[model samples]
Target: MNMLNVSSNAFMIAFFLYCGAFIVHAIAVMGRKFSNREPEAHVKKWGRFGLILTLIGLGSQLVYFFTRWAGSGHIPVSNMYEFMTFLSMMVIVAFAILYMIYKTSLLGLFALPITIILMAYAAVFPQEVQPLVPSLKSIWLNIHVTLAALGESFFAVGFAAGLMYLLRTVKFDSSAKVDKRQQKWLEFTLVVIIIVIGFIGTVFAFRASGYEAVFVQQQVTDVDTGGTNDSKIEKVIYHMPPLVAPHNSDTESYTSFLGMKEPLFEAPSWMNGVNAGRKLNTVLWSVISGLLLYGVLRLIIRKPLSRALSPYLADIDPDDLDEISYRAIAIGFPIFTLGALIFAMIWAEIAWGRFWGWDPKEVWALITWLYYSAYLHLRLSKGWQGRNSAWLAVLGFLIVMFTLVGVNLIIAGLHSYAGTE
Candidate 1:
């Protein structure tokens, strides 16, 4: 009967549909390799099916979104959990629109997986709806964030297309003189992806094993009573373990290895957000686990991760991929500017009594905008198209990620409204 329960169920169902779509799209692409006769027709059938499944999934998610909005009595984009979910949902919608224009089944292979990963990542976070703090009670919360997510979702599609372009265009044949720097950058991208997967896997493992602990400093007020408790509540350190726990966190529950905590140095005081320790821990674990994964793969294959992934995308059209990459950003940049910068400033003025503060989030937003501005300027005006433009598009999206995720995780500021919940 509760809204949360109903919305959660719908979200799960939508995720499965997305998973089904991924499988079908994958089959469509793979079928192209096998069915020489009527290959286009064969792939089209499967692609259509995949699109239908994706549309169904999107619809189900929309139902979940509205149901949550009805149940929660607000747009469900407040916390990291809800914001990530909403972003994935927007990614789905954006991908759907792009698929209509490009009609490429291969696009699904990249785009759908991104959404799936985002959905899985979002699911891992605490999903409880929190009462809005004073700043977030305004109508602008939805307008500002929802628009920004929509803009970024389009940029995400550009990232996917840019990635696909790099895979198709970049040489990995070993016979051709490969640029070591290109290989290194590609490997770096793979490591970034591995880090995300690593975080998800480690968190899932901890939760499955019921490995929960208490961080005495986790600032949380009771839901019913705005009263603080004398003793700290039990919280799971899901960011994989803190590389350096605060001196005060050496509790009985804080497990250690060989009578010492890993990276014995204490976390810097500046990292003092509510879940600062956990977020830092998550980053460390992500990097360490990602390196381990990259090392293991390198040992097995004796090649860079990018080279390993290149063959899959080798057959894709370089021009189409490049066009999609360019088009996505061209369409997205204006929307992103209007929403992330303009609407954000308007909301900030209303909420914080200023249009702009040098908040980390605000700074990063400006950086993202400037980076993309240069990207567009180079591509359109300076004739910096092809691999150079693709590279810029790819790098620009990284800036977007830093603005979106890094801001929330590393630096706490007025935009820390998400953490207030």
Candidate 2:
């Protein structure tokens, strides 16, 4: 069979393995619910099984990526499908690390489904092999793309942990009889919401402000050897090749179809000079709007912010959540800095002929890196811990998500190969 077919088949096998693991985890959880005691052995067995399956799935995914790289003669993250695969793999690796550290079987239950969803999403996008254009043929391709994926994956795990922290802190009245079934259900619901909101926010933000193109227009005037300008002049428009669609097609049409019908649309006037300003604006608005909505909903539910916080106040030692958040960030921050910033710059220099061109992807990656670095610095220097750290962790993940998925989807730049068609 061809490489593509091989990759597809491997992915299918991995998908099944993940699905089986998911079911086993569910069964383990159910066993715990029925017994009103931890199904320690069963949970442990299932967790190990799930981890093994995930490892196998991870191997299969690597094979798929390698085959695709061989087939295309470049990195696999040149489109949406590849990025999803990359994202899934990164998350799985991150989950494995966390599992090793915390020894929490519950994380497997949460993380496996997310990995499956991402892999499934990848399946829906196109998987055809296309030749790498002139721009993508750089050694930096691997470093920049891989590091960015790794950083995002770390953030994804942090988000999952944050959700878990939130769920573990839920209050259901120990004074009044709490229904075991209902409590479990509520816990599950809360975990799902935290994960979903974190994921969605990051995804949306990344989509809005991640990849961008900057145009530099040069006015070329014919000059004599003496350096006196002649009347003849030409306007030469130069810019980095767009990483994705509208810009790619537009550039092609502008250069190739000069006098013919303009087949591509100009960027909206509001978006003309600002590069990725519109997308950045969209992300800002989204964050603000989401926070506002959450506030309003909280207000409606409890009639007062103080009362709404009372349950959390009573059940959660914000200090513990803050410590967990700090620890996760401390662990993830260096990995992110190394992968997203240092390695990416090295790759950029090799691939794009510049180590730091402020390409949208580069810019966003730096922003993410700086945000986390700041988080670490704040925690260490300013004694910013607990609730403050947790909030920053949440925000840091948001920034990381934007750098990973958002830049590829929303912004336009050299990373176009990482987008959906």
Candidate 3:
């Protein structure tokens, strides 16, 4: 219990430190002209400060991880909370390594936000230290999951650099067809990121308010025991207000919100997973809150979000950002292959007596691997560079994210144990 408490405190310390690093990095990038200071000197001094803070934050997170491991009598990456937090830590590691190699403050500015958002997202899930399940009891769990996440973290850094490259180079004011199309897509990408932030903010807000809604979900299953049927009753709890009820569920206890005492509608029969309706409701809230946040920002800025932000990136070298992005992805590709594919197959064969299964998780992992493979080929062979390579890197990370998160949430398979409650 003492170790667990210490671990929790260390995690909080790390979170705050990372947030501080982000602000300092942003200052380093954006505050170059302030007080008529020499731009190069200003960036160098503040970028050093940001790097110090980031290193300290990484140290604190390591403390959190090892303490939790000691407290739990096993590695801490066995559950959603631990895995996501671990992923965020790995992202910091990847960012720190790249930042050191390139000495780029803009990389820190973009990458630290991703690390912070992932930490916040991880907090939205349950954080209790649960024992590893039978299948997850192998050493491969550590190798497969950790390496895969480390690889993905590099890919994440690549995404950040790629995005920075786009923001630095794209002609936001141009009305030409190519520039206009690029502007729209870039703004759309920024919107998706803001939506994720909104989702995290909404969850924490409702949680702090102590909101609750409960439902009794009744599911009927067909059995193969000489032609029989079974009815199962389960309770699904919603930490946020219920906007969509399960398909065949009845309200057990309800708290009215905004003059409403019932869900807006029941989920369709096709959405039959235990928490599918709740998941859908959460998605709806995320999109709503995200768009609302974007709208408010638009109103305040009086311009497209990307356009307003483009000037800050004007001094950055788009070519350097592109190079960093490509190098990071190149380094991560083989690590990802080893962890997500080779090690995974070894573990799966040992656990399930098969080397391959068309499970959703497995399929998505394969798809992600193939996509990145294509990306590398295109970059090396057809000489895809600048905007083209940047876009691919950005989109590749999205696919990696879906493989890690979305597949678990939306698809039921052998990896369902990895999903959130």
TM-score of each: 0.89, 0.63, 0.97
Error of 1 at 89 (Å): 0.7
* Model 1: per-residue Cα lDDT at residue 223: 54
Which regions in candidate 1 have their CA more than 4 angstroms from the true location?
174-178, 215-239, 255-265, 268-275, 296-302, 419-421
- Candidate 3: where is the Cα deviation over 4 Å? 224-228
Which TM-score value belongs to model 3?
Answer: 0.97
Candidates in descending TM-score order: 3, 1, 2
Residue 67, candidate 1: C-alpha displacement in angstroms: 0.8
lDDT of each: 0.80, 0.60, 0.91
Tens digit per residue, CA lDDT, model 2, 63-170: 887876776667787677887888888878887777787765555655677678677656545677666666667775666667667767766666555554544453
Q: In candidate 3, how many Å is residue 151 off?
A: 0.3
Question: Cα deviation in Å at residue 22, candidate 1?
Answer: 1.4
User: In model 1, which range of ten residues has the least summed lDDT?
Assistant: 231-240
The most accurate candidate by lDDT is: 3
Error of 3 at 249 (Å): 1.6
Tens digit per residue, CA lDDT, model 3, 33-66 = 6738588999999999999999999999999999
lDDT of 2: 0.60
Tens-digit lDDT track of model 1 for 210-288: 6544454544344556575544544435334556664345444655534555545556766644466666666677777
